[model samples]
Target: MRIRAAILAALLWVGPAAAQSDPAEAARHAAQLLEQAAEALNGAEGARDRVRALTEIIRAYEAGLAATRDGMRKAAIREAQLTAELRAREKEVSRLLGALQTIETTSPPLLMLHPSGPLGAARAGMMLADVTPALNARAQDLAKDLEDVRTLRQLQQAAADSLAEGLAGVQKARTELSKAIADRTDLPRRFTEDPIRTAILVSSTETLEAFASGLSEIAAGEIAATNADVSALKGQIELPAQGVVLRRAGEADAAGIRREGMILGTRPRAIVTSPTAATIRYRGPLLDLGNVVILEPQPDLLFVFSGLQEVYGEPGQVIPAGSPVGLMPGASPEIGAILSTSGEGTGTDRSETLYIEVREGGRPVNPEKWFRTDKDG
Candidate 1:
């Protein structure tokens, strides 16, 4: 076949275009993960190790939500591209349909019979044979494009419900994790915090450096020491949160205020974790930096994270690596906001800012040197 060859050519034309990316497939996978997380959340209540189960569920929800957001954004883009292409080819498609309709309605005998002579008829038949395949290919392409537009529209409509469910699930998981952390009492403590001394230090300190330098004064008794050393992982440590670097070390912000640390742009209520096993040197409000968690992974090295709505764990407690430290401040975006911003590509999803500082021997250093900052959020 001629028909088979024409069909193959039509398929070849559509194959690369459809193979570019499948946002609907990605969204479906994310939706499945979110569904699994919801099921895990139900079972977590009755699990023997509720805290650990809840933590995994929360992490799953966070991952699923992030993927879902990305999928929706991509879907929006793909839909726009397809819509624009269809509009651009509107006249060509109309002509193609009209020609196809004429071919279909006209008798084959009439099409082959040219008016001029036998030679003209023979020439017309050869031309018709050549043009038929091209017309069929165009028709196939037009049909595929129309089908893709319909599928993308349907996917976008379904995405709203999925996003809403995922947002609610993640929020519930976060709340439960917070409560579980508060009730937890089995973690090893390095030292008991003196509230009076901490209050005094908070009042007296004007900058984060001063508060960090006086951390020792806030301890009530002899500090339980450990030989935990993460210097070997100096440049291998991951960032404590899922975000993109907004401002690098010593980069000035819009207000022209520069700090010796990095600013990360994170999604609202994104989970922040300890990059490595570290002791909680300090946690809570300090100066104007909002809720903060200062982790001392090594004796003289400290990782300071600020701009949290809620902080976990008490001061002077040794927490394991990847333990939840806090949550970024801001309400999660609603479904409407997500859909409206999906096509904007303005990074409105990452609306919260997290301030991170690495202090080595009580002096600020570029966090990029300590953490792997090459990957995008």
Candidate 2:
């Protein structure tokens, strides 16, 4: 779109003033220039070629401007000449009229006077006949001079009309040239002239760059920290617990499993059922997290130690690598005690470890990275 508009601006440039000055010749030159500019711009590929095309367009406008000024000056001069000629014709017409009046005023009487004597009457008649021919001839010459003056005035008017037309064309071309030049340089001029808009564009570019940089930095940091945490957890050792191991424990089954028993921190009460109970806790007198210990060990590992007759931990309290958080109702929290399991597996009953599946960023990543599952024997 930008390229098209630029090309249009180039094409609109005024052509040489010669056409304005000499209407026929100048028009031919203008048509040729227009065609040449259109072809050059349309054919060009690179920036340099476009610049050359624009330069040609500018030249055409400059030529048109110069031509308009010259045409207008010539028109002014011709107008002055025509006015002088018209004035001279007017003077000639006045002079001819004066001569015609003089001839008429000096003429002898129209009717012959009755002579007091015979000789006087004959002489008066002879005098009248002699002046009549000269008077008629003088009148004819004055009429011819008046007609010549009128013709001169008409010719002067025609010259004035032609000059006016030339001037008008020159002015029109001049205006078009000015507008074309303005269009050509408009963008560059706007960027240079208005500080606020330029500053705004620059500032926005810098801000976007900074935001992208910051986000990249944050992602890099998160990756490094998460990697380090996983490495540390891999080196630790985990211990096994003597408790009930539930597999895919549902909510209703958990409630039935709970029983009234006195826990470490609370009085004798019913335990709140937690399905997939991957923890062992003593339900005692403590309010929240009373004896409820969540031992998240590894992926898809669950250990539900219900009927917590005793609880010994609170919320957010980290237990040691091996600690007894609770005591079940039928089972004892002591050494050499075995746990029961109901999973579809080998022997249906084996030692149970509180599986602590530590998750980072929501994915079930390897809990071996945070807890030592290999030591759970």
Candidate 3:
């Protein structure tokens, strides 16, 4: 489509004699491109797919939870069965004990009355006759049934215990699975992929102080300005609430003015081996840069700040770069720059690091060229 638009534009540029020189052709081509873009966007259905995937994941979790609950219910049923069996066995044992007790008491009375006078003997005989072998067999059968019930109850109890353990295990597994999904959704895939997070972690006050000391050592003497041609411009350009400026320090050009300042980095105090004073500057509108400074040092170039704080040094202050200029009294809203290293993301991607720009020939160069790798301070 772009090729087609270019061809059409080229044909139209061929002077007024061509019939294809209509201005409406460009609008028609734009509409076509818009239609194609819309079609491409519709093909992926990203939002709809994301929602559907999330819903499916939730449904999977619900299913797992339900299965675990059903397992628990089965365990409860098995427990009830075991309990009932135990009760039945207990009742049977009680009946057998009662029968045994009655047998023991009657047997004693029969033996005590044995060998008495003719009438007493006959009465004892009648009593012994009442206690038949059939009763003994019946008592043995009752005892056997009680033992069988006890054995069955024991087996059921074991089965119930196993079921309960299985249910608990399933429940625990389901809970862990749910937590895993939640964690996957919340946590990023790679920790180091986020430079901002890494910076935040390393930006502790003590670390900053140590790095500041390192900067002081580097900035002690006149550091060799590699791209001095671009870094020498000086002017307070007014930018909007969300705006950024990228410049370099070097020889003055037709449009660039020469300005010098101290080198100040992110140290609240001096470290063991490094100096403390730094050069800071302001570049934007009054509302944006209440206090701003650019600290230029060789090999390890940086930008310093005192955002929304009072400015201590004037534009031409000849103080050393690391000298205390001012303090950042309030938070500074980030300004996004349209540079390669600016990274790609939404509003949250804007970083809090001071904007560093390298310049030569009064034009901006990439700051990454002077980036330092030392962090041992």
State candidate 3's TM-score: 0.20
Model 3 whole-model lDDT (C-alpha atoms) = 0.33
lDDT of 3 by residue, 1-377 (tens): 33234223332332233223222232233223333323332332344333223222222222222222222233333445656765777876576667667657776556556556768878866865676565577677766655644554453344334334433432343333333333333221111123343233334424332433333232223333343222232232111111122223343535766323111222111111001222232222222333344344322444443242333333222233223333223232221121112232232222222223343233344333433312210
* Better candidate number, 1 or 2, judged by TM-score: 1
TM-score of each: 0.90, 0.20, 0.20
lDDT of each: 0.82, 0.34, 0.33
- Of the candidates numbered 1 and 2, which has the greater lDDT value? 1
Q: Model 1: per-residue lDDT, tens digit, 1-377? A: 22223223322322334335487776676677677777777777876655666666766776677767666676777888889999999999888889889989999788877789889999988887899899999889878987878887888898888888878887888888888888888889999999999999999999999999999999999888789899899788988887788899988888998999999998898889899999999999999999999999989999999999989999989988878999898988778777664346576788999999999999999998799987666
Off by over 4 Å in 3: 1-290, 294-308, 329-353, 373-377
Give the alpha carbon lDDT tens digit for every residue of 1-377 in model 2.
33344334332422232324532233333334434434443444344433333343333332332233333333334445555665766766576567557646854453434456657767866875786686567657656654544544443344334334433432343333333333332111000113343234334444322322222222212211111122334535332232222321121244565311111111112122222212221123222222223333322222223234444333222233333344323321111111111221242222222222233333334433433333111
The candidate that achieves the highest TM-score relative to the unseen native structure: 1
Any idea how many clashes model 2 has?
16
Tell me how far the alpha carbon of residue 218 in candidate 2 is from the true structure, in angstroms, after superposition. 29
